[model samples]
Target: MKKKLGLTSKIFIGILLGAILGLILKGMPDSTFKNTILLNGILKVMGSGFITAIKMLVVPLVFVSLVCGSSSMGDVKKLGRIGIKTLCFYLITTAVAITLALGIGKLINPGIGLDMSSLITQKPTIGESKSLVDIVLGMIPANPIQSLASGEMLQIIVFSLLLGIAISMVGKKAEPIKNLFESANEICMKMVSIIMLLAPYGVFALITNTFATTGFDAIFSLLKYMFAVSLTLVLQAFVVYASMVKLSTGLKLKPFFKKFASVAAVTFSTASSNAALPLTIESMEEIGVDNSVASFTLPLGATINMDGTAIMQGVACIFISQLYGIDLGINALLTIILTATLASVGTAGVPGVGMITLSMVLTSVGLPLEGIGLIMGVDRLLDMARTTVNVMGDCACTLVVSNSEGEFNKDMYYGKDCNNLNKLSESELNKDMHQDEDCNNLNELVD
Candidate 1:
């Protein structure tokens, strides 16, 4: 019998095979194979189904996990501190990512020779942007049910935070509710595992369709733009994130990378941070991050922290500017950074979100929104790469927060049995019950 391969191995194989199949279809002269069969048939159905399945879980998972995280904190003050730190860290990293991308784009000049003016452009309909005050006020959902229905992640986060704090303040009276979320969280995580079983096949269809539709000529024509964006993503993920993790937690890079490679692959394949949260949280637990920290930070990170997207905006802005023969002054670069940073939050969790924010960034600096369509050919591929970096940013923030709180598990993170690590066991829960009265008698109930 053939030995069973791990999920990661299977996913990698799916991606490989999908790429080969896509290339074969791309090379074919007749449009019959790609247009009639691959693009519109098997690949379309499976890919759409997979993305839908993942999205279905996002709201519930985030809601339950975040409530569990908030209630577990036991102290409202600490929760506040965690919130502040997480926000600051996310924003800081985003600024850094964008800054780096701008610097690199300038050096590489990815758009110098690309003349796209003759291409007709359709004006994208953009709603009036919210002011800073409006944005802050909007965080408190007028109707949380509406927020949930619409999948408004920022509103969900705010409402969940308030709910969790209220539960914590209620003390033993809220134990039943808290326990319910814990159970719900566990069930949801199991659902994630079940869904992930389809990842290999789903990823195959997604990749195959992407490559088959996006011709090699378009990809190669803008190879330099692709190279710059890809290079910046790689640098942000490895050099910048690795450095932050090392400096913050004193954790070894080898084990972190070993564990994170799997998460990165999922992020790349799915291109949705919310979709990858279940696995990311699971990986964090296996690496020994405290449940409270991992649950809170990762969900919040997914919703608000978008360093990878920031990098893309920064690079794309410069590339577009160069293509138009527009010279960017220091003030224009600053505007791009500020606009991109704020836009990342304003546009959180929308489908095809990057291009929307890219348009906003372009408008901020007097660059034409039409320039966005010029890069659409390679955007799908770059979206995959940047999404990987985005999730990596979330994981890095989780570790940093975990370390600062002294909740990080250096031993589990470095241990050889990391893959086999399970959730908190019965005996452990019992011991915790004996130690803390406010644990809501979870041991008794769960046992």
Candidate 2:
């Protein structure tokens, strides 16, 4: 008998093979077979289908899991505390990412002595950043169903939080409803598992499509910008997030990254946090973070937490400023930090949103709006790395909050007795439940 390959191994393999295939396609001459059959026909269909499959689960999973996590507490005040901690961690880390990007941009000088004639020929359409007032009011949805239909994540989170609190306030009267939400949450997770079965194929197709059209010419020209952005993202994930997990939860970092590898690959391929939400939550359970915290924080984090995007914007802003020989003052850098932080939270979690928010950051410091075109050529490649960091930020916050609230399962984190939980007798489970309030995860353990 042969041992089975895990999902993580398969996904990475897909990425590797996909990149090779994509490069081969890029090298080939332009032909109907390449464009009509290969690029648009198979790869596009499979990749888009898989993304649609995963995104289909995000709304239901967030709504159900959030309600389950929120109502499980039975205390609105605990929910409030979790909210504060989650937001603070998200916002603070985002600011740190921005500052780091600025430092990195200066060190690398990605745009010093660059030619902007070809790139900045036409002004890119700059999307307007929403005012803080508008973003605040928008969370209160006039029609939550419309928001869900449109996949408005922040709106969905607000509605879910309200529904959860109402469910908790009713107490015994809401028990049946709470049970229904819990069951629904389980079913949604099962759906996620089902969709993830096709992840490797989907990931392969997605990567293939990207590299097939992305020729090496643009890459050669903007390689420095690409290197700078990539370095910033790497630091954000390994240095900042590693320190955060160690400091916050006192957990070893190896197991955390190892468990999260497959999700990171998928997130890198998909490049949308909402599209990756299903896998992110599933991975959180494997990392020993409770569904309560994972459920609440991950969904909200996907919406407002844009640490990864902030890094991209910061680096791009600096790169652009240098392209036009604009010297940024210390006050301008401070403005970039504050503006990018707010813009990140206000921006949606869709793919390419970083570009939209980067416009805001650039405008704050009087840089050319058209400077965005300078880096657009390689944004697709860099986008994958940054999205992975955003997903990590979400998970890190979940771990820290879960550990602080005593909702985390250390035994699960250490890979001890994970399978044995299912073997325990009812009395054994009851005994453990008394010792740790987080045994609900044990009750729901599949293995």
Candidate 3:
């Protein structure tokens, strides 16, 4: 018998192949085939279509899962504890991420003698940013249906939390709606599995389009800024997250990352945390996070947690300050830290969100708004890396909170159980899972 390749391996292979194809495409002359047929035609359609598929389920999944998870908790007070703990972990990590970003940005000084000609932005428009009070008020949806239609994640989360708590209070009288949501959750989970079957293909197309259009040209022009952001991301993901998980839960490093690699690949390709939310939750559950905890924490974390975004804003603030010859002293740095940390809670999880928030950070200390226009070229490249870190932050927070609440499965996380999906990296894990009558429909649904 031969071993079958896992999703993680397949995704990596797609990335490598995509990079090769992209580089080849980049070297070719501009033509109708390259622009219209190849890059814009096949690659764009496949990549965008796949992302759309993933996003198709995010709203319903978050809503139903949170409701089901919150209602399962008989004691409503525990909800307050988990919510507060989750926010604290997210904000603290965001603060720490920005602080590290500042340290590295100053050390590298990416803006010294930076190329002014490389900036692609034609205008100095700074996007409108809501005040802190406005952001807090906005979280409580004016109309939840409108919020859901608009995909306002914070608003949806608030409504779902209140509705779930109401159901939990009503006890047996809420059984019908509770059962309805639980069933809907199962369907949403099924949709995630079906969509993931196409991941390698989608990831390949997305990476292929990005590298083909970008090539190596963008990096050299802004190499220092790119390097600073990349280094900070690596540190946050590997060092910050690894140490936090180890100290908090005593979990081993290798298996944890191995399980998370599949999720990382998708997030890196899409560059949108919301697009990756479904897989993020599924991965946490497989890693032995309790269903209730995974359901609640992962969604909330995705919406409120912006550690990776904070890292970029911190670096960008210093980068812009140095580029334009402005001095951001200690008071300004402290202000940046506080503003970025709180802004993390206010912002939604989506692509280009960091850029919007970057404007706010730069404005806070009187740095030039035109500076936002400076890094637009390479931000897309850096964005992929940051999104990977953002999602890792979410999962790490979920694991730690789960442990604190005594909901983490020690045996499963350690891979000692026969049915442990976390331990089973091969195809047999899927086979084993399908043996259960509850999941018997999974295969048929996909078929």
Candidate 4:
């Protein structure tokens, strides 16, 4: 009999095998394999189905988890503190990321002297822009049931938070409501497990489709832009995040990076901070951060913390400006930073969000939104790097917040088994062993 591997181990194997298969398919002749039914029908359909299932779970998972997390605090004041801390951290980091990206993009001049006419263009569709009054009013859902049905995530989140808080206030009377939600949350997690089972197949297809069409040529053409964006992600991960961790928790940078590398790899491949949330939270807990802090910070960070997106906005703004031969004044620079930060909040956690947000940023500075076409082909490749930075920023913030709250465990942060040590202590191990003996004795008695 073979021993069963854990979820993480299985995922790792899936990723490795998928990469090998993708590479093999990549080398085959277009006539031989491009028209193959296996690639077009089986692999593509299975992969897309898996990704869709995961995405379907996002709004519900976030709303329930966040509401439960917030309301469980039992004190409304603590909710305010968490919100303030999270928002401040997000805004500050975002400002810094854009600044760094702007500096690098200007220095590299990736879009300078490039012809804008050569870029591809698609027909533009007008998007509905809400007024401040409407946006605020919309947050208060007229019908929570309708919001969920319509997949209105923000409205669902607002309703869930209000409901959770109301339940907390009702005290003992709210027990039924709390229990119901708790049960619902557990069911949702089970759903997540089912969705994750198909992840390897999904990831393999997504990557294979991406690379098969574009190959390395797309990356090569946008080499300078990609390099500049990539450099920001690397610096943010190693320099910014490492320094923050060292200062906050007094942990050595080397070990922190070692533990973080694997999680970062997943984030890079997925190109989604939210998709990487579970792994990021688990990794942080393993590194000695308290559950309370990890539970609070990581999810919120995944939703709103976007250092990588900020960096992209900065670079994109500069790239657009250079393409149009416009020198960005100090005022324009400040406006870009402010708009980018705000846009990050409004953008949904979906593919092409960066480009949409970048388009918004460009529009703020009087640059043509059509300039987005210049980078669309290479956007998928760049997304991986940006997402890794985004996930790293979230973890870094969790550490900082945890350290400040005095909730971080320094010994565990540097120790191995950071993930399971809390649940499987020496005392628990002994208890389990005794329980096994008792069960055996009872079985013998029955015999």
Candidate 5:
């Protein structure tokens, strides 16, 4: 029998091949085969199909997993603590990310050598951002079905937690529904596993298409800026996040990185934290994070967390300021941190959303909005880098919160006797079932 390749190895190979093929196609003369059939046709279809498949798992998985996490909490106060801790961790890390980026950008001075005379500047018409009142009101979905239909994650999360809390409060009466949701949650996670099997090919297509279509001229022209952004993202992911996970959970960094390798590749290729959420949650479970922490924190982190985006904004702010020869005062620097950090919450987890939020940060710091044009050309590659950090931030927060709650499974996380953890989960299920006879039997639950 042929040896089976691990998911991490397969993904790495895919990324390598994709980059090679993309460079070849990009250098070749324009031809129908390369343009229509290869780049625009097959690669496009495969890449989009992969994204759609991942998204297909998001709503059901998030709703069911979050419901399970909330109901399993057994106490509303515990759930609140989870929420508070998760948010605080995400925000603080985002601030840290931007602060780090600014320091690096200043030291590197990415905008110093670039000639700006020929750069085309535009006045972007940024859409009005949501106010505190609007955000709070939007959290309480007036119509949850509409929210689900629209794939509104915040509202879905809110409604699911409320329903889960009510089920917990009902005591024995909610056992049937709780059991049903647990079964559904298991089934959804299985579906996520199924979707992940397509990741290698999906990542290949996405990366190939990106490099093929995006020219390297912008990248070469702004090499300094690109280097600064890439370096900051790498440091944040490996150095900052790795240290946090180690300090908080006492888990070895090597094993954690090995487990999360595939997740990082997916995030880099797809450039969307929301797209990576399902895989992040599954990987968190594989590495010993409790379902309650993984499900709740990952989804919520994807929705509001923008550590990577904050890094981009931070570096971009400083770069543009240097480009325009503007001396930023202490107050101006503080404004950038505050604006970028808060703007991350309102920003969605999609491509170019960071650039949009960066505009707001620029306005906050009295920088010229046109300065955004200086970095726009190199944003795609940076977007890929930052998205990976965003997902990593989510995983790091999940591990920390789980450790604090005493729900973390060290043995499973460390790759020692994996079946033992499965056995423990099975035992927990049995205990829950015994407590409520009306609950569905374990055998009746579908794999």
Candidate 6:
């Protein structure tokens, strides 16, 4: 008998089928479809459950993996160089993103020549902004258990890194705990794979539910805004990242993009930079980045990098201003960039944080926060694309930094063997070790 379709393929089919069904049902009268309780309930349950499972793994995965990666480094100071480079790249790229968004939004004026009476308002619960001292102190985690319980991923990451580094410093004395963490890391990866098995069902539900409720009208209404946002995102991905690749590593742009395209698509579809972290690291390694650098920088970038978010804020600020007929001055534009960049750091890794941060940006520029509702209807659809861009930015930074530090494989980067290079680096590491062991055994026999 022919083999059944795999999980991913199955999910893809489901998604396509769901889209068609949803569109069909959307055109039907309410009384005709309102009684289909079973279908609706199943979709809701499966879709929400899948998202929950994905979210459930995010915190532990980030904490355990960061600890495992950081602790294995064997030196804390080396992280400083990586940290500096990573932060500098993230911040600079974010500024550029916002600038691009702002410039483009102004030119396109997507919100202009449109009425606003129909837009719905969505008020987000705003968190208190802590002082720099408090933020830094919070990083130390007064109680790690509490941090984990609260799902404070950044705090958990910080605590894990510190604990991991301390373990490394303790040397052989900390072997048991170190080994335990290593085992935990492996288990988490297994969990990730298991969860991924449900991806197709989850994605189908997500996309179907979205399209079923949201007809193509919203897209039509926001076409200009979406177009502007997408154009800037693509330009930044190609122009900014490609330029950095050439400047830092002397690598050819075509091959670099070809290697990164698939991973970029995954990120764009998922929208969670953290979710895309594994793929990003794998791709970097396949392209010849050292494990040490890729492992450390990529995770950190997933947490703090906001080039895409920055761009959204920039465009949104301008878009909102045009809607309200307010002209943003030089100072106001500068303020939007500053606030958006900072807000990106503190924003939690959850759905709708982008809108929250965008609200913050609007407030900084004296734009009406209520104007946020104008775009909220279409925000979810745009988020996936922006997120994909965000993940791409993170990976690009990692590649550039790795290249600069001489940690990238120049041959793999320049070669046409991109297909074979797609294997996860961890597997390659295991193969090398097995070969080394065989060689050592032969040498011992000779002696």
TM-scores for every predicted model: 0.58, 0.59, 0.57, 0.57, 0.58, 0.57
Question: How many angstroms is residue 192 displaced in model 6 relative to the true structure, after the best TM-score fit?
Answer: 23
Superposed by TM-score, candidate 2 places the C-alpha of residue 69 at a distance from the truth, in angstroms, of 20
The residue-by-residue lDDT of candidate 4 on 1-447, one tens digit each, is 999875445545654555456566678776634646656767668655654565466556655654564456464345666556666777788888888899998898876655442322333221235444654566578888897876554466567667767877777888887887777766666776676566555655654554454444323435788888888877777887777767766767776778789898887777777787788889998887888878877776676677898898898878766655567776667667766664454234556446545655664556655445446545667788888888788878887887777787887776756457756687698999999999999999999
Model 5 CA deviation exceeding 4 Å by range: 1-78, 115-221, 420-447
Off by over 4 Å in 2: 1-78, 115-221, 427-447
Please say which candidate is ahead in TM-score: 3 or 4.
Answer: 4
Question: What is the per-residue lDDT of model 2 for residues 40-93, given as tens digits with 9 covering 90 to 100?
Answer: 788868876775565566567666655765565453355888988987898899
Cα lDDT over the full model 1: 0.73
Superposed model 1: Cα runs more than 4 Å off: 1-78, 117-221, 416-447
Over the stretch 1-447, how does candidate 6's per-residue lDDT look in tens digits?
Answer: 999985545655766766676676567676534425523577667666765565566556656765765566554355878767887898788888888899999888887765442322333222234544654565577888998887554466567667877987888899999899889877877776687677666656655554565555424536788888888988888898878877877777777678778887887676678777788888888888899988887776776677888888888877766655666776666666666664455233455456545644664445665454346445666788888888778778888888888787877777756565656576798899999999999999999
Give the per-residue lDDT of model 1 (tens digit) for 1-447.
999996656766777777678788878876766676766777867766765666567567667766765666564355887878887888788999999999999989887765543321333222235554654576579999998887655567678767876898888999999999889977877777787677677777766754564534334536888888889999998899999988887778887778888898888887788888999999988887899999888887786678888888888888877766667877667666765664454234434446545654665556655444445445667888888888899889988898898888787887855443544465677778777865557667877
Candidate 1 or 4, higher lDDT? 1
lDDT of 2: 0.74
lDDT of the candidates, in the order given? 0.73, 0.74, 0.74, 0.67, 0.73, 0.69
For model 3, what is the error of residue 31's alpha carbon versus the real structure, in angstroms, after optimal superposition? 33
Model 4 alpha-carbon miss at residue 4, Å: 32
Q: Distance (Å) between predicted and true CA of 351, model 5?
A: 2.3
Roughly what TM-score does model 2 have, to 2 decimal places? 0.59
Sequence-dependent TM-score of model 5: 0.58
Error of 2 at 127 (Å): 22
Error of 5 at 168 (Å): 19
RMSD of each: 12.2, 12.7, 14.2, 12.4, 13.5, 10.8
Off by over 4 Å in 6: 1-78, 115-221, 416-447
Error of 6 at 201 (Å): 25
